[model samples]
Target: MALKRPLSQHAQIIFRAGVESVCGDRLIRDTVQFGPTEIWFAEHCVDRQAIDRIILVGAGKASGAMAVGMIERYQADAASAGLIQFAGHLNVPQGCERIPEHLSWPDDLTLFAARPAGVNEPTSLAIEGTDRILHWVSEATPRDLVVVLISGGGSALLVRPADGLTLADQLQVVRQLSGGGADITQLNTVRKHLSAVKGGRLAAACRHAPMISLVLSDVLGDPLDLIASGPTVADHSTPHDALEILNRFDPERSISSAVYECLNQAEQQMLAPEAMSNVTNLVIGNNAVAVDAAGIAAESLGYNHVMQSARRSEGTAEEVGRHLADMTVEMLRRDPSRHHQDALITGGEPVVRLIETSRRGKGGRNQQLVLAAYERLLELDTSEPIDFDRLVILSGGTDGEDGPTDAAGAWIDGEVHRRARHLSLNAADFLRRNDAYSFFEQAGGLLMTGPTGTNVCDIRISLVDRLN
Candidate 1:
C-alpha cells in the first residue's frame, strides 16, 4: 500500500526537506572528513597518528545520530589511521539509534538510555549516565581527543544535580520553571547553576585534554553558553543570574531547599575560565539553517511572494500565532491580486503556560499556536471576510515532537474551523483549557511526523493563495 501524504502536501514537503537538510547525520557528513594522514572536522585538522585516543562524550536528542555518523566516518578511515582508538560514553534519548540488524556498536563505545521517548524530563537513569560521562572525561589524558556531541535536550539528558541537590530536587525545579513559561535562556541559567556537569564543568573534567564540540543548536542566536547549558563551553552567567531567574520564575520558591542552597553556593564553586581553554565549541546547525532551507523549498513550490518572519518568535504561543495570522492577512489584503500565492516562514520555540486545572490536557506549543490563530482569523472574518479556501497556517516542532503529544504540531485552515463548528467544538474553550491537541484531533488539524532525528526548535509557515 502506498502511504498518503497530508492535505497540506506542499507545506509538509517544505518542512520535511528543511529538517532533513540539517539532520545530525547529514550535518556530520557535510562538516567532517578524513584525509590520508589528517582528519578534518569543521575547520580543524588533526594528525591521526599524533592522537592516541578519541573520546566521545555528551548528551542530546541528536547526539546519538551524531555519534553514529562520527563512528562510521572514523571507521571509513581506520585503515589509514590505525594508531588512534575511539571510545567513550553518551546519554541519548531511548530508541534513537536505528542499529543495523547484523551489526552492533563497537565494544569500546558505550551508549546509555537517558530520557524516555517524547518525555523531556530527566530521570534517574540520565543521572547515572552523566556520572559515567564525567568519569570517562576525568580519566582522559593530555593525548586524548574529546569529541563532544551536544544538541537540543542535552540539558535534560545530561543530568547531574549540584552537590547538595538530589534528582528529585532538580525535577521539581525543572517542573516549576517549565510550567511557569520560562524561556530557554532562563531555564538554562538555572540548570547550569544547579548541575555539576553543565556550564563548562564537563570540559573541566577533561583536565587539559583537547576537546571539540560539534553543537546542533536548538536555541535562538546559538549562544555558546546556553546550548545544552554549555557543558563544554565557558559560561559568563553567574550564580546571581540563576538566583534572579529563579526568583522571577519561581517566585514562591517551590524549588527544594537543596536547589536553593546549591544555587547560592554556585558563585564560589563555578568552573574557572582557564578550565575551558582546551575546549572549542562550534555550532554546526541551527534554526536559521532550517528556516533558510524551508524558504528555498517554499520557493520551489511556486510561492511567488515568500517572506520570512522578521520577529524573533518568542512569547506565548497564542500571541505569536495571532501575530503571524495578522501578518498573513495584511499581506493578502494589500495586494490580493498581485500574487497567485504567498508564503511566510518563521522559526522559534514558543512557550505554553498550562491553565490551572486538576485535569491534564494533551497539546503542545505548536498546537496551541495554530488553534489560537484560527480564533484570530475568525475574528477578522467579522470585520472583513477572508477567502476561506485560500489560507493555510501550519506550526510544527523541528524535532518531530511537540509537548507530550505524539503530533509534531497542527495545521489550521478555514476548513478546519468549519469542521470544528460542525463538531460543536469551541476553539476558545479548548485554548483556555490548553486542549488544542484534542480539538485538532477531532477537526483533522493535527500534524504527525515520527522522529525526524533532528532538533532545531519549531517552524511555522503561513500560506496564502488569493486566487484560490
Candidate 2:
C-alpha cells in the first residue's frame, strides 16, 4: 500500500487550486485575446482599428491583478500596442499593488490604494480613488473603449456618498447592517442607493463610449447587480428596498437623518439609467469555478470528490460551520468496504454577526466557522467511536482574506483536534467571544496565506478516508 499524504496538506492544495482557477491575472487574459485587428471577450470582439484609446477603470482586490493582465496583453500583442493607447485608474487595497518583478509600474494606468490592507470599510482614500475612476471614464470619447475590472471587495474599495450623506454616515449604516446579519444583496441594495457610482451609475458615466465590465462574482448565484454593488450592471432594486433593509436592521432609524433623507431623494432618480444598455457586464469568474477546480484537484490527489456552490446565502457562519461538521461526521462514519478516499468541496460566502460586548476578540467569518465546526465535532455522538485519523476539514476565503484578519481561513484534522483537547481549550468560549484566531493560534489549525490574487467568495473542503 502507498503511504497516504497528510489531509491538511491535501486540503491546502485543493484550496489553492480553487483560487488559481479564478485568479484575476489569469482570468482576464483567458477571456480577452488579440486576433489581428480585434480584442475578444469570449466571442464578442472590439475592433482595434476603431479604438483611439483603451481606458481601464476598476476597484476590488482582484482588479489589481486583472489590470496587470491587461498590461501584459498590451506589451505582448503588437496589434493592441500599435492601435490603441491605454490609460486609466484602479482602486485596490494595499499589497495588491505588488506587480511582477520584471514589470515597471506604468504611469498611464494608476493602481491607487483605495484602502489599507486588512480594513474592509470605505476610507477617504477610497473616495479619492472613486473620483479618479469617474474622471477617467468621463474623459473617454466615443472613439475610446473602456474595460472595467470588477471583483469582490469593490464595495469597500469604490466609495461615493449620495447627496446629504458623509462617508461616516455611510460607513456606520453599512457596519450596522452587517452586524445585524444582513446578506450581501440587502447590504448592496442600501449601498447602491447611497452611492453616485454604483447600481449602473458607472455604466451611465460611460456616456457614448463603449464599455465592458469583467466581473469576478463573489455574491451568491453570481448576481451581477449585487456584486460590488453592480457599478456597471443595471439596478433591479429600489430606494424603497434599501429603506426596508435598513429598517429591518435598525428599526429605531438611528442611522442618522442623512441616511434616510438620501434614500427618500434617491426615489426621484431612475434605478436603471438610460445608459445601462451601453455596457456589457460579464461574469468571468465565480465560486462555482473555484469549487469545480478544487474538486478536480481532489480527484488528482487520489480522492473521490463531489462539489457544490451555494446559490444563496447559507445563513450565519456558525450555522454553516455546524452543517459542515455534521457532513464530516457522516463521511467519517460511512461504510468504506471499497478502496478509495472521499472528499467534499463547497463554495459560498457566510456571514458573521458580531455580538456587542466589550469582551469580544478578533476573528473573521472563516475562523468563526471553523471554531464552530470544532465545537460541533466535540459534541456529536456516534454509534461507534469516531476515528478522525484520516478525516480533515477546512474553510478559506479565496481572496486570501477573512474579515479583518491576516489569516485566509482555517483547517481541522484529528491531530489538531486532539491537540485542542489536550490543551483543555474550550471551543465554545472562543466562539462566543468571536476570537477564533487566538484559539487556532494555540490549537494549531489556522490557515494563513497573505493574499492569493483572487476573490470568489469562500471555499470549504472536507476529506475522509474510505479505505477497504
Candidate 3:
C-alpha cells in the first residue's frame, strides 16, 4: 500500500525520515529487523566459518531491538536465535544469552528511568543489568569473538563498578553531572573512568577473541569514546581531565573511594601493551544520516533547503533559537518578495538550562527554542511593526519527545502571542518557568508525534514563504 502525504506532511515526513533512515533496508537488509543478534551478525558474519563461535553482548536504548535484529539475520539456522532466547542467568563466550534488561522502548521513559531504582519511572537498573551481565563476560576465553553492540544509554545499562565503587556511588555522580548540565562527552569521560565496562576496558577483557563494535551514536559529533563511554573503543580522555571536571564543578565534592581507586587502575591498566590490540569499532548511524534523510524528504516535498552546520551550534536553546530566528528573519528580509517557498534544515543536540527556581515547567530543548524565538519576535514587534504571515518555524526532538512533555515542540508562528493573550496566558511567565508546553498548547502550536523509535538528538525546520 502506498502512503499518502497530507497537507502538513512535510514536518511528519522529515521526522520519520530521520528515524526510519537508520533501520532502512540498506542498513537492516536480512537481519531480524534490529536487535543485539543482528548487530552481532553484521560484525561477525563477514568471516563466519573462521569465526568458530560468536559472543554477543550489548547495552543501549536500542540494544533490545538491535539484538533481536541480529538473531534474525546471520545465524544460518534457528538454533542460534533459539539459543540466545533461552540462555540461563548468563551466557559465556560462543554461547548466546539475551540479557533480561532493556531501556524503555521510547526515550522519555529512558531519561526518567535514570532516577534511582524504586523511584517513579524506570531506573538505570531496568536496562542492561550490567553487574550480572559482565560477571558472565569475565569468563570468556581468547577463542571467542566478542561482539559488542553499543548505543546511547549503554553506559548506564552496562554499569559495573571497577573494583570497589558501589552502584550507589556511580548513580550519585551520574545524577550530579547529568543534572549539573555537563555535555555527553564530559559526563561519559568521568563515567568511563569509574567503571569496568567503559573506556576500552570491555575490549581489554575480550583480549582472547577478536572484538568488533557496532555502534549507534547519540553524541553530537559522534565521538566514539563519548558514546556510551566508548566501552569497546580506545579512550583518549585522561584521569586528570576527569578529576578536573569534578573539582571545577564542585571543589568540595569527592567521588566514592571506589571511583578514585578505579581511576587509578584505569590509568595503569589502559597503558599495557596487550590491553586494546584486538578491538575494532564501526559507527553506522548518527544525526548526519538522519539529516540527510530529512533533506531528501524535503526535496521530495518540493521544498528547497540547505543543510545547516550542527557542528557550529552553541549556547542555550533560546540563544540557538534566536540565531535560527535571525537566520530566518534575514533570509526572509533578503527577499521579502520571494516567488517560491523554502525550508531551512538543521539537526543536532542543543543545551537546555533549567532555571534554578522551583516553578520550572515542562519543556524540552525543541519546544524551548520555539518559545524563545516567539518571545524574541514579540519583543521585536513592540519596537517596530512587522509582518509575519506565511512564516513558521518548526522544531522538535526526533524521538517525538521534548523535555518532560507530551508534545515534542511546535509549529511556532506570529499568532503565538496574540493567541496566548486571548487565553490570558502570560508568555513571559511561561518562558521564565521554562514552561513551553503550556504556552504552545494555548497557542495551538503543539507538534505532537508519537514515539519515533529512534534518537539522534534534535531536528529543526524553518518553513518560509509558504504559498509564494
What digit string (tens of lDDT, one per residue) describes model 3 on residues 1-468? Answer: 111323234666676676687641224344322233432434444444334445666665554445544543544354443333211021111111223243112111112122231121224453245544454456656545566666665666666666777777887777666556666777788988887778887777764667777777778878888887887778788887887777665556655666666666666655453587887787777778888888888788877777763753356787878878776665555554453557788887777767754777877778888878777766766776545654567787764667656676786665654577688877678877888887887787788874444456677887666344
Position 91, candidate 3: lDDT: 13
Alpha-carbon runs more than 4 Å astray in model 2: 1-4, 79-81, 381-383, 466-468
Q: After aligning candidate 2 to the native by TM-score, how far in Å is the CA of 116 from where it should be?
A: 1.4
Q: What is the TM-score of candidate 3?
A: 0.79
lDDT tens digits, residue span 181-218, model 1:
88888899889998889998898888957888999999
Best by TM-score: 2
lDDT of 3 at 356: 59
Off by over 4 Å in 1: 1-7, 77-84, 101-104, 305-313, 334-336, 357-360
In terms of lDDT, model 2 sits at 0.87
Candidate ranking under TM-score, highest first, comes to 2, 1, 3
Instruction: Please say which candidate is ahead in lDDT: 1 or 2.
Output: 2
Q: Candidate 1 has which clashing residue pairs, if any?
A: none
User: Which lDDT value does model 3 have at 236?
Assistant: 83
Best candidate (score: lDDT) = 2
